[model samples]
Target: MSEFTVSGRYKNRDGYRAFETTIDAVNEDVAREHVLSQLGSRHGVKRTEIELEEVGE
Candidate 1:
């Protein structure tokens, strides 16, 4: 299964919390794009304001 997820809170340093479920994928690029698209369009967040980081991980 392919899992794409996000975790973040507004205005909390990184301004969000996000992560993905465990899954295997042939190509990871498209999954990332999908996650980003969902976050921006569905959540009303701009792409520029979102930055992936290694905090909780």
Candidate 2:
């Protein structure tokens, strides 16, 4: 696994909220999935509410 910095925006009750999170994954796809899963469960966000800005190691 590698360390990745993923930045994105998500919709909340108020509006859109920006987020930057670090994750360990094999690739960018996995990192994205991880972020989506976390945000969905933790923040009650839908997949369409999240927009990925950047993914970097």
Candidate maximizing lDDT? 2
What would the TM-scores of all predictions be?
0.50, 0.95
The whole-model lDDT of each prediction reads: 0.51, 0.95
How well is each residue in 1-57 modelled by candidate 2, as lDDT tens digits?
Answer: 999999989999898999999999999999999999999999998999999999999
Q: Superposing all C-alpha atoms, what RMSD in Å does each candidate have to the true structure?
A: 5.1, 0.6
How well is each residue in 1-57 modelled by candidate 1, as lDDT tens digits? 455443433223555665443333434565555556766776677777666442221
Q: What is the lDDT of residue 46 in candidate 1?
A: 75
List clash counts for every candidate, in order.
9, 0
Q: In model 1, what is the error at residue 50, expressed in angstroms?
A: 1.2
Evaluated at residue 6, the lDDT of candidate 2 is 96
Poorly placed runs, candidate 1 (over 4 Å): 1-26, 54-57
Error of 2 at 42 (Å): 0.3
Model 1 residue pairs with clashes: 6-18, 7-17, 7-18, 7-19, 8-16, 8-17, 8-18, 9-16, 9-17
Top candidate on TM-score is: 2
